[model samples]
Target chain A: MNGEIAAILAMDGIASGAIYVLIGLGLVLIFAVTRVIFVPFGDIAAFTALSLASLETGGRPGTVGLVAVLAILATAVEATALVRNRALHRLPRALLFYLVLPLVPAAAVWFAAGTTLSMPLRIVLSLALVLPIAPLLDRIVFRPIADASVLLLLTVAVALHFALSGLGLMFFGPEGVRTKPLTDTVFDVAGLIVNGQTLLILAASIAFCGLLFLYFEFTIQGKALRATAVNRIGARLVGIRPTSTGTIAYLLASLLAGISGVLIAPVTTIFYDSGFLLGLKAFVGAIIGAMVSYPVTALGAVMVGLLESYTSFWLSAYKEVLVFGLLIPVLLWRSLSFSGTEEEEAEE
Target chain B: MKNSIVAAVVAASLGIATAAQAEITVGFVTSQSGPGSSIGVLYDRGMKAAVEYASSVGAEKVKLIQLDDGSDPSAATRNARKLVEENKVDLLIGTATAASTSAMVAVANELKVPMIAISPISVAANEAGDRWAIVMPQPPSLMVKIVVDRMKRDGVKQFAYIGFSDAWGDLVYNGAQKPAEADGLKILTNERYARTDTSVTGQVLKMMATKPEAVLLGGSATQGALPPLALAERGYKGPLYGTPALLNTDFIRVGGKAVEGVQVSAGPVIVAEQLPDSHFSKKISMDFRAAYQKANGMPTSDGFSAYSFDAWLVFLDAAKRAMATGAKPGTPEFRVALKNAIFSTKDLVGTHAIYNFKPSDSYGVDDRALVMVRLVGGQWKYAP
Candidate 1:
């Protein structure tokens, strides 16, 4: 490739890599904080895209049903907690948080169905539908076994990913849906035209990273999440409820997935099975950071995207095999560097 | 005593007549309940409609027992074997993809039962055994010939190729190469990708760098639509040529406005109405559409559907010929007779082509079966 093409490919790579970073950030955050690998992150992204497609067609998204179901289940858990603790007087607050809050978004979604809404409204609605399920999933699947080993949590995450994919296929058929590009302006930079979407993607990624840094460094909830990530039990001892902290982290992570999906949908086709590959690529990026460092993981993800773009030009067939093959060497290096690292506690 | 003997003979003759008139068992193996099912459902139902139409027109009773292969070639082979061994189907038909079609072809040849293809099994005439198997759709070679012709006519000199990293891609690329090369056009680059690939920017960029005058996407249906859409997004302003399988409505639906002005070689059934009145396939294609719509509420938008429909029509004719020669539906002799009758078919016009099955050519379709079509405003228009 010439210099111009190379530059353009790099831009394309970084644009896509931004999406990977969103997913990678989510994966790393969920893994570090909750010890759950968050296997369904990509699926949630695809679900978000599909919901946007549904909304664009003036139809209610099926994800609204998922939200309502999760809300009811979470509410029941809360109600049982209040009743069993003999705290019936606090039932109203519990109901308001668990029962009423979730339905508001779902009801808004239902009322918004089949009405020609602006693109921004549809995007927000998509985010609103997807954001709640992360905590609901945490409460429903991971919370009961929050103290369990990482391996068991990983297994549960994988199972949830598989089930959610099957549900995605049932909800949205086996076809890839592409939404319109958020922007159509193409510019010729040194005789190489770049899509406006690419620029928007890069800008959004930087902005999101800045916002996230601010949230974690300045916000009290963010500090609680960090404390939980440091030590789940210690956070509880320090009066920071790990559940609420974990829930906030999940919400942030899921929001990233939702936003990434909507942005990436214009660039590529998003299908029910599309998430696994994207998720796997992000997982590789997370692995590169030893699944800990956000800046390192984001940088690694950009490198992965660029490498994938360049190699696919020369060896298109083995591109995936090569990209995925990076894992072996990275794992070997990590093992050699951190030989004294303790493995996750095995489940009984 | 003589009159009693006459009565016994009459009763025995009636029994023989009923035995000869038994419902002809035909097994259909297809990629049902799997990734290919969306297309498989259409082809399967299309054949079902053809059988129903034949029954309405008072053809010999036929029992089409379908087996789902779940999109695996091995499963399709097993289904083919089970149908022949357990169900005792005299004739076998199946498979919506070339790889699985190859699998079913082997079993059909081994079991010595006549099999008809509902999809393009292969492009080579050598693969077609004399009396065992035949294909209904225009082969990939014939279809690609039209694509190359159109590309040349449109003044494209350099061709860049991208297709599925699988058998179908290989078939299309290989088939497209010979004619394309014969025309003295340079093939700048060849890229392969999986059907489930989310992005083709890398490959598309490579093609963009090569700056080919035109691009050929060697894929079928919705999967085939990906590259063109990607190319359009990347602002590659070259004509896009596709295989016959790009005729499906799903291709149009997913491809959206990106597919407009893209040229594809497909069966005349796709643009049946647009085909001239003098075309051989026009009348039969409309009839097949009518039968398909009458049975199912949706119109037949895919030419692959007509493939199975044509398969059933040929089977009906072959079964009639076999029955005339004193063959019974369940016997091995009946299968041999059906095979021979199929081999002898001449000048039979169906939805896709004028099929003249011979000992040398099982795929009896000609250029008449295919039309060069261009996407115009989300509709396939025949390019004269």
Candidate 2:
């Protein structure tokens, strides 16, 4: 490939990878905290995007913009309510409280941006919506069934999936709506054209990743979150409330998913049914990351994006087949490599 | 409401008293849900308008019963039987999709109720033979032949076919292939994809690799337009060709500027605006557009209005003939009279085209009905 084409491909890969990372992060967060998969994460993203797009603008700010404003206000009220409740009585709970606080700002930005918002706004809004959702889900479904066996939890997740799918159909209609692009500008660099929105997505993904790194490396709450992930009971003994900490982790993951949705909406229009496919891909990305290690998961997402781009370029017709072909082998390799660690965790 | 209820009660009593008496009822079946809802909407509009027009002319009220088949063939068969055996509808008009239409045809033949298909004529029309069935619209194969002939006249030689892998696509291909070959136009590539396939980028790219002068599309409005748009984005400047399906307003909206030069062979609906002498056509076109806009809050496509109008007109003409022949009101004899009248139609001026039905011909094929159009400034305009 020519330099320009290569650059364009690279940019496309990164943008696609960023979307996957956000979705994977949410999945990882929910799984880490609750030991349960949050299947509705993608549905929420699809619903929000569709609802936002459907908002008609007669004049002034549109319905989507108005909804976004209301959502932001709600997030603020909820955050304040949490603070007033003395929700973080324990040190571990306090750490989780701090971790989830960023969600308020993220959601506000998301709502403020609306449908006319740029790619960056989409990323921020998505993250914000998802963050609160993760904790809310933990409070509602997971917490109620916390005492249930793994099999029971899995069954509940399946039930949640069906319910969410139905809800999506009822709200959004069966036909998928194409999302309007943030910008139609195509930048020609060295003979390779890249959509401006894609570049913005890449930049946003890097910034979000950097922020995540800083949060986990430097913040007290971040370290506690990590400690909780390593040994839940041990962390609780060390003054970390595993439940609250897990909720915080889930919130972060949800936020990432929301952001991914935002980024993805502009690139490819979102439908109520889009979430299942995206969620499946994100699960593969997570598994490829060994279902642990944030950096590794993010990297896995990028690789998947690259694979998708190349397959679409070359095979085109059987691009989906190419995706599954890569996913199966990678999953098998990861399973063999992590068998020992899984056995150790089982014994413990 | 009280008076009508009392009258209905009295009528029911009288009807029960005369149980052995014959009754004439018209059954109208169409897709009210699923992917083909648009077609159903058109059918409803056409049938209702025709009924209204007939009533305005002081004709007897033709009891019209409607059944929703939801575009499923099995549902259509069940519904056809219910209309025929249970409801005892003397004449049947409907079954929108190819599958549903075929199933209904078999039921109609078995039940011996004359069937008038209002939707697109399928490939099965060729093998249908001298049965009690007649299609109002031109057959799919003939439509394709006309499209290719028109394109051949325009100096287009090399061609590529892009269509959804379904019965509709098969009909178009079967019709176009022979004529195209005879005209000396080389077929560069022929590619088919599923209707639900989001991206036709692969199929399009493969076709583009062959570098054909023209691409013929045989899919629904959305599917027909997208691949062309993708081709335009890839800098392919060749003419995009399509069947009547591409004449829809949705195609223009979705395809945007990319569809500007695309040519399609459609019925007379799109060209109704250009026909200055035809007052009936002008009025139907105007009223349809206005009603559709009022109902859906968006401009209705020509296909929806034209198809619906033609379907209604066919029924109205038949009903009038039945009334003229002195067939007893609401009897099986009246239904047969109406069916025979429809078959006897020689040159009826319609909103789309003049329909001529013959008892000897199993399928309806009106040679004068087809018109070729192109997407010009976001609307279908006369191509040549």
Give residue A298's lDDT in candidate 2 (0 to 100): 86
* lDDT score for candidate 2 against the true structure: 0.66
Q: Write the per-residue lDDT of candidate 2 for residues B1-384, one digit (tens) a residue.
A: 999999999999988855533334678898877545557766776566555444321334557789899878899999999988877776788856767887888887776677877766542332445466777777787778888887799799888887766678778887888988889887776676544343455456667777888888887665466677668866789888888877666567667788887877877666766755543456666665565555555655556545655666676677667678877644667656766887887667676677777776745545557778777788677754
What's the iRMSD of model 2? 4.7
Alpha carbon deviation, residue A316, candidate 2 (Å): 3.7
- Interface root-mean-square deviation, each candidate: 2.5, 4.7
DockQ, per model, reads: 0.34, 0.13
Q: What lDDT would each prediction earn against the true structure?
A: 0.82, 0.66
TM-score top scorer: 1
Error of 2 at A214 (Å): 4.1
TM-score of chain B of 1: 0.86
Q: Best lDDT goes to which candidate? A: 1
Cα-based lDDT at residue B133, candidate 2: 71
